[model samples]
Target: MGPVRAWRDEEEIELGPRQQRAVLAALLLNNGIRLSNDQLIGMVWDDPTPSAVMALRTYVYKIRKTLPELNLKSRDGGYTVRAEIVDDCRGEPLEGLRSAYFDAQRVRLGDSRLKAREDCLERELDVLELQKHVAAFPLRERPRALLMRALYLEGRQGEALDHFHQVRALLIEELGLEPGPELRKVHAQILNGDLTLPRRPEQLVPDLIDFTGRAEEIAQALRTLPGTVGITGMRGSGKTVLATRIGHLVKGRFPDGQIFVRGRDVANELLRAVGVENPVGDKAALWREKARGKRFLVVVDDVQDAATVRDLATPGSAMILTSVRRLHELPGVTWLKIAGLTEREAREFLRKAFGPVRADAEPEQAEVLLERLSRLPHPIRVIGGKLSSRPGWTIEMALLQMERESRLADVIPSDCAAMMAPLIAAEKQLSEPERRMLMCFARQDAEVIDSRKAAEMSGADAGEIELVLESLAGVHLIEPLVLGRYRLPRFVRFCFGLRTAELTS
Candidate 1:
């Protein structure tokens, strides 16, 4: 439970310890269903102990004594809290839980009998409460849809349509997504003054088949409403995919439309989305004027300068920007820096990209392959695509080839070369001393480098080294770590080392 206390009539019953609270929560969540001793132990402790079952039994005893009204019974080699007890619960069900999943369950249980019951007003009040809970999760659509249906059934068509528009705008402004067919159909029906409208044909771009992981990042970006959220990561770290996925997720909110454009063509794309053909006046001014009243999700990807970010970020619209470099100059934009996938996420990605049969069959080989790819999603997907397309190729063969290749360019997909080229060019544009500092980082064996040590290696003053490090960090070539230390990705360091070696040779 959230604050960890139970109630019996007007008296507050104490539930001891966090583990005890967890036990109560697990039992309450599965109120009518028996949870086995092992399941309860697992729920209480991330790593269950042999004594965990005894501890669980003790907790159950305490709970039983505290709230005798709750008919907590042991049956079928497990425990269950009866549904009747839950029904009689006076205060909120799982009041202190505060978890979105628990809140959603509460809403589901509340509305479960709505169709069978004749209490329309009660159902309406439930919908209102559910809406309040759901407001925290802007990316979710089902609850909003339910609210629309409830309002429509109550003959409040105007309010239903208003709700639709509000959610639609929120979706656009927050996620750069459009309403799904179900919501669209409801809107159409409301507009036509008819209770029933045939489901509108779905209009959507095909989702990335190899897309995996970053669910949390996507959710965070979605939650940043009415403000710019920037996604920055190393090249090919899936920043664009994340931004695009977010755009699709929230597209329904922006009923006006979603405009996705590269850094160079933001002005053109905004104009195009707003249906401005061959505008004569200042494009930026015209874009702001046109976008002032409309709800649009503006995605500016591969941003090369602060000017593009400033130009596309209109006052009324929501913006999502993706770039290899950080947009430090832009104020009020929340930045989320993506990194390589965890080993688990990488393994799952491999399983998804390559057929699970092959990927799972050779687990050791899959591990080796993920290591070779550095757990970067783009490289994993690329290699997975290659292995999948050629049935004769095995994970072992791919791993062997990756090990033998002297250069990352040789091991990775050919397209990765193009992706790295811009970054290399950016590095080339740096001053001689700055380039030397980066080269020193490549030569070092340590994972992190500080300005003092970098200066010693590069034969530059510590002051100059610090300034160059900040510049490199701004462009996302290096990551600033704790206490002014900097870390370069293994792949980037390797590439720089190879380039340095080639130049000297």
Candidate 2:
């Protein structure tokens, strides 16, 4: 079902407009099946016009006229095209095709091709390839089972079991069920040595287990793909985590594979992924050549600047970039900002960490805790995990310490060292004046601080403070408000407070 084409012997048949071709693809994907006019229209058009039924008829007529070798019949008010299906799946299924229905078919076809490719392998298995399969179809037990076998064969029994746990957690959480029997059996086989072995997979980190919320943003970013999507947020607000989730969901949409670039050596990481090894001159050109005629994804995490990867986000495939900066200058980019979790989402994180019963017992206290944490994901997760681990502590007990807490650092759990890494790295990127202004923001009590207030606090010229404010706003340390006002986001302010407190103490 890859790259839909019709041929009579050595001669290839021509197709019509994209919509008409879409009709053909739908018919081919569901070959020899009875498709009513409504079905065809629904698959090909999002908002079918009044002439949709007529248009479907015309497409059918054109198809029959163009390729008279095949049978295109209409009976009982339904259409059917009879032909022998051919599938090498050389490239993406129906490449250059974009439609929700086509997207679904592409995933189905991609999975089938993956299975076929695995079956043909004689001795060795490419674990990475199977990982992509599992990522694309997370709930599909077949890929997970297959992955288990591959891992077991490679003597990576521990990793195989880890994969099992990841999938089982996903199943129980997402579907309110355990892994399917087939999947459990595969896990049993691996654990008991009866068998083989297997998201957010292959070059990407596993998505956060308690990836709480951001439903609307996720949907919008996904809808904006086949183009660039920029997710900008304050440090530790879960930008990378959201991008990774999107990367997993769109894994099937891109047939080639997904490449994740996190640090320096971006050129090498991308080039080598596509077999353009040791690319010397014009690596961009080589990348373009490889990207052309293929569907893949590039998820650049925590990008420092938009210009750095402007050329890489070209037309060949989709890109998702997570940055603390706004990336306002990047062409053809749609930006989504993540400030922090909603109160509901924050509570959900707590619920997951401490179990629903405990979390619900003190909804009032939980709300107070959420306000104090500012609903930022990383700190919430860290703090939630911390409180969860110490069964002796309750939400109220934690609140008591926070209420009288002078050094915010004193309140942080000792085990949450990793939580500060993002902030520390972000601090390194800021200029001295910007860093000074950020701490000034921490010391201020105002909700929205203007340049004058910053100047008053820092004892700097108002004009110079304005520049610093703009810089901080550019990187999203402070969110710009109307009439020249700005807010140091709750989480960043909290972190700055911690920094200030530690120094003073």
Candidate 3:
């Protein structure tokens, strides 16, 4: 059934089968465009003979007569569907509602990388309810994808995985074609937790032109006395961005000396043997060697596990450790948490990215550009990159084809290697109970949950769960929200979630 509605304050009219079919064909073909009599005739009926023209007029007359009843209009010699007749909410512009509608759909579809899974699942349920009730509406590929994503995000993992497999199988059996790599990747990402915390390289480089905002936060972290300062945030929220930016900003302050090693390499040295037939005493050995030389400013990014991060920070050395998990053990470790970008900041970024191309021609293009970019810096960067070559794309057209032409992940890197080290660390430190707790949250939709609730969900006690959360938190695999709450950053969440699910499932 198509989703359609008629307007109030107009005569009520019902269309016969032929008239409904003809009008639907015309509306779909013209879609916000003007269509002439001949164009309408051709779209409605393949070829109109002398009588065919008359037959076209008969159908057109029926549609036209029904329009007043439905408040539709044939303006400028072309039929235009009236928004009033759509039965959608009033006062609010249809475009605004449509944008919200699609955004809700985007989240529901789990394509909205910015929002957490819990939020997306809620939206998916709302959209599914709408889908069951709406009538006389144009169908689209988007709504179908939205449903699939909703199911996937709703923690219906087996069902979601099966549906994607079924889609792949059907595409092969019916269309004799393979699903596109992007679709396959999305399916894999959702099942494997890749979509939750896909990587972005721009987050790592502080000097990059794209790194805007977070200056104040970074400055404050750098100004935190002389003790060990730790920067933590949700994945893709810019912990490393702030840390790297602070390092560059304060490099002059620490001109005497600086030492930096990423957590992964640091952990490798700490965990394994160094010389043949001899075990590496502790990973801290290397850091002890490096800091022994001089006064240095040490910056370790993605410092997973407390032991690994602690090795790099000598008492005298100025050190900064960036991680998604919470590190409370480092006696003087000052914590700085990064939050999401404000709507205004995200909008301003889109304007800057798309402003140049639409400078003279269209003032409205900026709004269109902003809408398409969805206020995410990484995706906005990609949109800007694509528009750099073709300065002529009207904002509307560009946005409409945004998802159709490319998956959002394609614009952003998928490896997220810097973010994955914590998971590796967490895996290394896992105890039987901790492993069970981590796997429980890893497979669920919520990024973070209360410890009591998590323990309840996992059939464990608070004391038992705290040890796991703390252990995971120690290595930067998960972060503590307040007293009992903990959250997973997308990066570590993605890798470990997959591993956790694979192991437990």
Candidate 4:
């Protein structure tokens, strides 16, 4: 009952397009039951199109033409499918499709899959087997709760409690929600030492879907697996997104469970997750003791210092750290510097993300729009999502409108805008001189700033300007270049340029 597919006599029958298959799935999941055109439309589309009924009929016609063996019938002003639903997979049911009906069905079908796994694991009573099983369904909370209970009962209480923290972090990271009552209940029982035996883990839930680009970076990182990885980039360069997507893909290598930790308290979170409740004495040693010999992954987001997370990467595991600026090295840590998408990659991203851009662009017109957005994924997603939803808006039209707006933020729909969280965080952490230096650099309309010119503009000496530029570069607000110059990213200029005007006007 996962995803919409038709199989006759063990050989899979071709289901037409996604919407057509959804229509079939609705009928079959409710087999022997009929649904009206309106009901099917409601189930099929998140926001139904105007000619939904006619389109549904066309899909039904295609389905009938494709599979003539089935007794799919039209009656009572509706259609009904008369076949049993059957399927299997270790993925979110209807994994890629998004709709309210699919969301409801995903929850229902996911619970059933969870129950089936629980029954089978209960029969075997093997923790090792359960660990492997959980690796396939990492986002399923109930099974993870079951796994935690089993670990605690097997005298691995520290590992069990550590998993509880991992679950808590994972839940917060993915869904932006706290653990549900059932999971919290199991955790409480574990902490109180009243846990009973039970079983299950996989996929890191990713924020970026059908992600494009970063092939070389992903391949290089994957090649050097089971070691610390540092993915550093400018604030808007998609550092965390790339890390999480890559982390989700390579989860099977670590069966002990992949832990995602963010914020300043990395050491404490790791220490707790590794089951050293109060490792007040020799905390690093206790952390090493707990994390040692366990094959797992630890992803620390927005990290500042390398030393803070260096020791957490014990043997037999991997770590992926995402930060705005380049970090100091840890032993065996492979570093990847994530820059903006190449022009070709940017064009492909725009074409894949928004179809209007798929139409031929006049030479350099699309580049104008990309220059404003800096070819960064965050800004692209922001403007690209708005453009994708409105097919009538061509790249030329968008560029014209963007020029009309006083600021990039003005043209972008408030609802569709990128969070710009990383940018704001980086701004808040800036020192006074760094802030002024950034403002001085941002105020100029030029793409690149000469050091001598920046010093002249800021009325600072050569030495002071150099230090300020170095500080700005350290925080990644400005990038250094050949010949004592710096390049300010277009998106950053679009953002702070307006602020610079307001401050200096």
Off by over 4 Å in 2: 1-201, 314-316, 403-405, 408-418
Query: In angstroms, what RMSD does candidate 2 have relative to the true structure?
Result: 16.2
lDDT of 3 by residue, 1-505 (tens): 1223343468544655653455554564345666676666655555456675666556667766765443445666666553322312332221221223333433443332222232333333454553442222213223334445556666666765676676677667777787676556667777667454211112224366667676667667756835677887544455666677776766655433444556466634322221222336554665466345234466778766786665555545577788766677777788887654565675556557667446335547555554433333554555655656576776565655642423233322233323243345447657877766766665573577688897788787779877777776665456678988887654344455556544443
* Model 2: lowest-lDDT 10 consecutive positions: 194-203
- Please provide TM-scores, in order, for all candidate models, with all chains considered together: 0.55, 0.60, 0.38, 0.58
Q: What are the per-residue Cα lDDT tens digits for candidate 1 across 448-487? A: 8787877777687778778888888876677788756988
**Cα misplacement distance, residue 298 of candidate 3 (Å):** 1.3
Q: Which is the better candidate, 2 or 3, if ranked by TM-score?
A: 2
What tens digits encode model 2's per-residue C-alpha lDDT throughout 1-505? 5566667778977787888888888887777899988888889987888999988899899988987766888888888887767787787888877878888888888767766665433124578878886777788777777787788888999999998999889888889998888788877887788662211125767877878899999899877898899998878888999999988888877766788998756666788886666889876666777676566688989887655686776565888888888777788889999977887888888898778888898989998878766787877787788788888888998777654453564444444345555676788889999887787667664468778767786788888888888887877777788756997666576667666676666
- Tens digit per residue, CA lDDT, model 4, 92-179: 6876667899889888887777676675565455678778877887787767777877787788889988988998898899999898
Task: Go through the candidates in order and give each one's C-alpha lDDT.
Answer: 0.72, 0.77, 0.55, 0.74
By TM-score, highest first, what's the ranking? 2, 4, 1, 3
Q: Which ten-residue region of model 1 has the weakest summed lDDT?
A: 114-123
Model 4 worst lDDT run, 10 consecutive residues: 196-205
Kindly provide the TM-score of model 3 when superposed on the true structure, using C-alpha atoms.
0.38
Which runs of model 4 end up more than 4 angstroms from their true locations? 1-203, 274-279, 329-331, 356-364, 407-421
In terms of TM-score, the best-performing candidate is 2
